[model samples]
Target: MGLFEKLFPRRPPDADPRAYFKTLTAYQPVYTTYRGGLYEMALTRAAIAAFARHCSKLHLEIVGDFRPELAPVLGQQPNPWMDASKFIARLATIYQVQNNAFIVPVEDAAGRLVGYYPVLPQQTSIREYGGAPYLQYEFWGGQRAAVELSRAGLLTQHQYEDDFFGADNRPMLPTLQVMRTQDEGIVNGIKNATTIRFLARLAANLKQKDIDAERKRFAKDNLEGNNTGVMMFDSKYADVKQIESTALVVNPKQQELIRESVFEYFGTNEKILTNTYTEDEWNAYYEGSIEPFAIQLSLVLTAMTFTPAEIAQGAGIIATANRLQYASNNTKLNIVTQLFDRGFLTHNMGLEIFNMPPVEDGDKYYIRKEYAEVSKLNTETDPTGTTEPKEGDNGDHTGDP
Candidate 1:
């Protein structure tokens, strides 16, 4: 061994727990009852659920000549524990909340791909060693595990940023604070409304004992929702007046604005929460929000699951959202008819549009007779536009001359 090597032995890169321990602090407030429970709030819950549902409905396909043999593992069932829909939904929720999702591939005894598992971003941390990233996973039971990025089998889908870790919704903290305050105000208003207050007028010289007796009688007779009459002494001069209760008034526009802020931050819209989006609006939402997610996921899956040689040979995965899901049957028919009439789409392409099998000779393109090219404008005329024929031409061009 060299003198330098003998003096200081080289060690494999190890994850530093302290590096990510601070991020856990940021998550602490999110687990609290008031703030963290925002997910359970109507607006927040609805937005997250809608976004997650949109993502869950996407269809993943292996689009290449040399398709990977792990289609079932990646598409149908990520593992025996969860199907594709459930897995995708969970990942979507994680993505909505944390702005990042991590998929760890499970391997069989022979190191062949078997299943997939999702790791919570809050429980995972990334650290760099020797200029390469390593992952440190802290399990629920306080178990800590480390894996190098090269062998981590982890695929990450996240909003693009320079951090490489991922972007989060921390930017929404101020808006969330306002939402929490509003919720607390509403709850407090409701609670205070239940308590009935009464203003009582008494004689100037009434005795303390008499005043106490009158107050007790008022409480007993004026029980909530009970209007029984109470008799009082004439000398007491007691008069009871019930305090008016006003219903809490929440501004509809302000509430909508707050909800919209939350939805917009998550790349969704208010229509998803209300389930009132038109077909076109739904398509726009998919394109704006879900399509980017699918693309990022496809790229991540290809990078993590396929070998460099396989990718070079055009073997990779693609995640595609079913656009037809948001389109009506009539709309699909109209679109297909228009495309077919314009000769912009082939028969097989039309079939693929509706997800049907292609037929023989379906690849041909056609144009209307009137729209066909006019070579000479008339079959009887030559290129010079002359109808006369030379010496060897008969009347029928049969060489009988």
Candidate 2:
């Protein structure tokens, strides 16, 4: 080993006792929306109930259909052919504003709501296939009209939502018309899309489960649902192409792990750990390690966990560094050196105030530059009026601002 390497050989201290149990085990939040317009949509009453059963076993909250009023709203105007398209557009507007519906709080074994998934109705077709895209009706005029008007109107154009102030934060789904046109015979395309999105969201929420229990539930739920002949398929030139379909969307076990981890991070309350740290420390950690690790680990974990990982990963790092700084044998220089030498610690992991990872030759880690100039704005000395007693001014205080 080189002199610098040997001199700075990393040591394994008791990595905070809290960290041993923080193995990405928390449940993340997820939601699923189903469309029931099609007779053969996979999200049948029985299917949804079965999916809910599996979700319960994995600590995932199940959100059923939100668009139950679709038919009522569309059929309200007494025009199924022309006004139907306009009605679908209005539904899209409502969906864009509210973003989600039917928020289900996923609980841990202790019945604490760690994360939430909100189910919505499949209001738009996400499927783009063949010469005639399934969701094409909303974007352009269907067979009767030459130009595809906005689903609702020009005011609520889908492209308008593609801006910085747009509703991309809101999720979307396929409208019944889009689904019907995409798949002839009104195949359960809406239900399938809703189910797929829900599963994807669920997979992005929790991880780690009681493997045996999860597997058993998976098998049971798969069999419990009727065949129903609801299949996920791709349409090619008006030809039906069946895609592989599974009863369960995500691995129940991985989701359990992520959910467990998030729960631990959130503790019993629904609050994230970001509020637990002092503001300065919070800024330092976020700008340094928290954001980086959260981005990196999201690859292995779910979106639900990504939220907490961004909040909690810094906990262990901060605690470790604090403990080392307190030990007499460990100084700031030594701590920074050991931290850098650790294989898992990335340069951008926020190791500053000591020997930070050298800035790359042509990289822009910071653009505003003012962050570096942030003087320690001591709250103790700010002009909130002296918290400490002033000379002879506090005993007989007269109130005046």
Candidate 3:
């Protein structure tokens, strides 16, 4: 080797663990997502669950021969214990909640791929062992496991600063704070609405203990048990004034904006969560949210499952969602009526659009043959399959019979 090449030889990617997992100083918080569970917010949690459920409806399939076992395994159940939909939903939820997710393959005793599982580690650290990268998982139950990086598919969003992992939800803290404050204000308002409060002038010579006793006596007599809606005041007070308790009047517009900010962050809205989105809205959501997820997962799983050569040979995985499934009944009817006879879709497929069970012979494709090809309408070429124009007939036949 040349002297320069020998002296400055590049190290492999797994040479150092710190390269991917940055070491934080003592003042900085430890590795955690959303600053240690901001998703506990009801709105955020609901949005994540709804978004995940929507995405998990999509299908994941293996496209090539590199991993034939995955095709069947991904169809309905990825593992013996978990259904495919549940697996995908949990994966999506973890990825959203933590800003990162890891998918590791499960193998049988024979070393054959049996299933796939998404791991949620309370703490994740990268380690280098024998010149290879490994992910160390620390579970909340005090259980731990290690897996080679190559065997796991890592998916992350909002990724920046860190090399492999995604950034935390610190940027979203302000929005969540608004939501949190608004909720608390509403709760406080609801409580204050039903209670009657008053301020009254008391006798000047009354001691603190006497005043406390008087207040307790008033509460017990007027507010504790069921009684007529009336209060009798003694002459000890020079003035008595009832305080009007108004419910928390949060700015409706400000609250809407905050909700919109959260919805935008999570790629969802009230309509999306409630499943009232129109066809166009659903399509937009699918394109903006689900499609990118599908693409990333496809790539991540493809890489995790195949070698470079295998990928080059057209072996890969694909995840897809049927946005049309969310179309309105009228739109679905139109689609079925328009495309069914064109042979672009089969009878069973059209039925699927309506969520109906397939009938006998539904697999058959029926294409209309009543219409003939333009060239085959030629008067000069009856019973001949040739579509070529005649040499003299190339000129426009302007004669009008």
Candidate 4:
């Protein structure tokens, strides 16, 4: 055997991660956001790749990470872009944002951040203002600034699915909905008790990182910001489902920076654009480019809440452990991809919404909402109108489209 096979004897020779990941027929797609400058699309791709590298090194497994060997066994992967697009297209058909620009999905490889095809203003008189720049320079600058808001960590990563299964149900098996049998003849009259228990353990093992400590650790190690942090948390009792919390740098100077960033985003005069451009002109120029960037910025802020030191200092952060559980390589890349798909996030206008929970016994408990809001984007508009083309799918578009 060759030296390559000595350490990892079972790894496939043609182990392209993308190919491998394509095998997960039932895998879900999680969306994440990226903004800032003109190269937001490229930056988002790079960040995701970097995250994947980190997870691979640490050996953590994100659901989207490709594994062809596992594909034949798992079934199929879900096409997220198509699903998101269908949703957005429906919304666009139902509701329009008046003059404001909106985006569906655009990939970096295509040289677009969101699928931004600018719509020009409706000009009534052709001769009076024939050559007026429908979108003034300031409008472009504002749109650019909106992308920058993503740098402020104002975007969110949301994981949703259009359907529960793949377009084709292969490897068919009967669906079994099971529950505990009340008053069965025998408590131990099971033929496969051990196997069922093992499966349950495997499920827990896959999602071990969802625990408060593990999620917080992942956030602190990967996310970066001067005064913000994120942590995973649940209430003290069973009544509370798990949620993420954040922290912020509440000092006056930091607050000022945030406000200025907001001003740049909403335009200096508190409108979508400055006075140099007329309403019709501004609307058309930006009708398709601004909304997604806005969405991305809001989500970034949500991720930036976790502190590196706080997460790294926890007991569960084992340096040498399962790569799937660690925040490196595959894990980071998966997060980056999901974040890119989720779209932009809104800035909370500098509200110190929540605080971080106290650490106990060398373990952090929760996330805070200091100077931030973790609300979803306004859904009154077409939620599905904002999707880009499917890059990795084998052409399986389901649902609305």
What's each prediction's clash count? Answer: 0, 39, 0, 83
The 10-residue segment with the lowest total lDDT in model 2: 144-153
Evaluation by lDDT, superior candidate among 1 and 4: 1
Across 96-148, the per-residue lDDT of candidate 3 in tens digits comes to 88889988776665556667778777777666666666776666766556667
Please provide, for model 2 over 203-307, each residue's C-alpha lDDT reduced to its tens digit, 9 standing for 90 to 100. Answer: 222335753454345435443453763533222112323345543333457445544443332121111222344435434534343333223222211322223
Model 3 score (lDDT): 0.76
Ranking by TM-score: 3, 1, 2, 4
Better by lDDT, candidate 4 or 3? 3
Best candidate according to TM-score: 3
Give the residue spans of candidate 3 off by over 4 A.
Answer: 1-35, 189-196, 218-230, 370-401
Give the TM-scores of the predictions, in the order they appear.
0.73, 0.16, 0.81, 0.13
- Per lDDT, the best of the predicted structures is 3
Q: After superposition, how far is residue 183 of candidate 4 from its true place, in Å?
A: 53
- Tens digit per residue, CA lDDT, model 4, 1-401: 53222212232222212221121335432111111221122222232232222222221111222222322211221112233223323222111211122222222344322221121122110111122211111222222111111111211112123121112111111110011121131244333232222111112443445555654443454343324445333342233223222222235664455445433322232232233444343343333333333233223212222234433443111111222222344544554354333432112210101112333342322332232222322122234655333446444445623
The full ranking of all candidates by lDDT, starting with the best, is: 3, 1, 2, 4
The whole-model lDDT of each prediction reads 0.66, 0.29, 0.76, 0.26
